[model samples]
Target chain A: GESVGLHLPTLSVQEGDNSIINCAYSNSASDYFIWYKQESGKGPQFIIDIRSNMDKRQGQRVTVLLNKTVKHLSLQIAATQPGDSAVYFCAENAGSQGNLIFGKGTKLSVKP
Target chain B: GAGVSQSPSNKVTEKGKDVELRCDPISGHTALYWYRQSLGQGLEFLIYFQGNSAPDKSGLPSDRFSAERTGGSVSTLTIQRTQQEDSAVYLCASSQVGGIQPQHFGDGTRLSIL
Candidate 1:
């Protein structure tokens, strides 16, 4: 019954603005989490990741914040660009094998 | 170095036919995973392979779905008597190790069953 779910199905933002996508996971045992970006025809591309021990992790222009207390996760993209328009997903590493449980993606659209 | 590679960018077959999908993982990578993505949906874990360990097939949707890894590198997912419901994109990913590692993915093979 444990599931990883997203708070938003779609997010539209101006190209110069920042965007925030949210995810909530029910499995507290999951220690690792990852964010991926998927373009229209491409596979999911690794963006950023965070472990339970850490509350936040930063990548080139993205930041992943984890709130273990509420089992919530968020991805922040600064200066969103047209190239950054894609479907974003959050996945939790579950079980001993570390199989990822992915949330329904949030389609991010950046308008110029 | 190249990332994970999957063959036959697209596959079209009949409902009663069988199909084999291939995945060539990155060199020296010991972990491989298969996932299915229906249109506008999230990735569904199908199977995983880690080094010489037996593969974890827990996510396989049904007996019609099966996979195998040869010599710990290339992998093949076979679907027997495919159905219309089997139409989806099959994605392959690989990592240096299994647990908590960032996985690189291939463009995936789009399977269309008629």
Candidate 2:
């Protein structure tokens, strides 16, 4: 079965430092990927997304790198802040209807 | 106010009872999705709806779980004969279009089977 998974369960970083979370997916046909941030008691919020055609995509303070050859994906956050402390999830669109398969999240803790 | 909406922020019900969760996608969104999140775990895809097409219920956990989308807008996920293991957060999300679009999510309904 096709699945998406994270490399780490938790990542702790100091404020003003950079953070990188990694994910591995098993589906070769998946063409779309997304990164979401979920705070305590909140839904997963969309952070950034990248299509298979692009190797990298950048948002305001975040970047998503997709390596289809190795089926690896990563989310990079610059100058991590307390507000950025949350569970980060990586998802791949595995179906034609746009259903997503999400990886077990990586809890990001930014220490001030 | 423009994001997806779900009703009953939390629900506590005894085992064997049936409960319904609601989701209202963003206006004009063509795609809607439901997912479940167990405590400290990741999201699991439950179902998907796009436009007027038939829903994809491939991810539904069991026969006790079912869903319906009315008029391509509001959706209801019904769980019958709920079990203790059904306790989780049910999340709803919508995308402006179907393929490759970023989905916006709503605060989920926390269903606790006591």
Candidate 3:
């Protein structure tokens, strides 16, 4: 198992502002990256994903940026909303083994 | 259901009791995974099942923990002689047919060992 870490444990933002949650991974061989948002007492919901070949991938209101060089990944949420508040986690897959190494996660709090 | 489903949303048992947790994956999905999340901690890989072949039980914490998938549709995770440290949320997830695909998770079964 590889170590996936987060730079921050918590982030608070106001409405309409952009939010950036950073993650650092140790497995350089990881080829796939994904971001998941989990609400209280619920399972993780897929937000966005990016392959190692590409540096960035975007989805509605969210974007995932990967830096293979530094083994770092970040999820950016545009126009933060109250509904966007949750714990975000970054997961990485080294290959086709189907095992995703997960980070400890960062709690995102969006203010109304 | 459109997403993965798990049974026994909450379980409380005495120490040394054996319990089973069941999971019903989405139809036609051949890949299933089980993970454990401790309090204030991240998800920990437990076991993975692909199709009908031998499951990858490397992530299992000890011999007391085991899992099985029947017909590649439903899965059951059993704990033998439950311990106090075994208290945690057990989550089950399913993916298309390969590891590269995204995984859909269930609400998870909250197991409390008293």
Candidate 4:
């Protein structure tokens, strides 16, 4: 079965530092990717997204880098803050499918 | 003015009991979705609706799970003869379009089958 997985289950970072979360997807046909942040007791919120045509996309204080060669994707957060502590998940949109397949999220904890 | 809303934020029922979860998507949004998340598990796609047309229920885990959207607004997911394995957070999300659009989610209903 095709699946999306993460490199780490949890990541800890000091406030004001940088954080990077990695994900690996097995389905090569997946063309769209998105990153979502989920706080405790809340629904997952959209953070950023990137299409297969683009290798990298940047948002406020966040960046998503895609490497089609190795089927790897990464989300980088600059100047991480305490509020950035949450679970991050990477989802893939394969072909014309309306559903997004999610990865086992990475829990990010920021220490002040 | 609302993003997405789900009913009965938490539910507890015994095995073999039937449960119904409701979802009210944003006004004017045509696409709605239902997903499940278990403890320490990722989001599991369950069903999707596009307007009042036929829904794509391929993601549903089993024949015991079913969902319906009414008037292209409110949706309901029903689980029959729920088992202990059915314990999970039932999340509802809505997007402006079906594909390539960011999905807005609700807090979800946490269902526990004892």
lDDT of 1 by residue, A1-112 (tens): 8799999999999999999999999999899999999998899999999999999999999999999999999999999999999999999987767679999999999999
Top candidate, metric DockQ = 2
Q: Looking at candidate 4, what is the lDDT of residue A25? A: 98
Q: Candidate 3: misplaced stretches above 4 Å?
A: none
Give the Cα error of residue B24 in candidate 4, in Å: 0.8
True contact recovery of candidate 4: 0.69
Docking category of candidate 3 = medium
Give the DockQ (C-alpha) for candidate 4.
0.76
lDDT (10s digit) by residue, model 4, range B11-51: 99999999999999999889999999999888999988898
Residue A61 C-alpha lDDT in model 2:
92
Model 3 lDDT per residue over B4-50, tens place: 99989999999999999999998888989899999888899998889
Q: Provide the global lDDT of candidate 2 against the true structure.
A: 0.94
Model 4 alpha-carbon miss at residue B21, Å: 0.3
Question: lDDT tens digits, residues B5-27, model 1?
Answer: 99899999999999999999999
Instruction: List the pairs of residues colliding in candidate 4.
Output: none
TM-score, model 4 to reference:
0.97
Q: Of models 2 and 3, which has the larger lDDT?
A: 2
Residue pairs in candidate 2 whose N, alpha carbon or C atoms collide under 3 angstroms: none
- Point out where model 4 deviates above 4 Å: none
Candidate 3 residue-wise lDDT, A39-112, digit = tens = 99998888888888899898998988999888899999999999999999999974576778889999999888
How well docked is model 3, in DockQ terms?
0.78
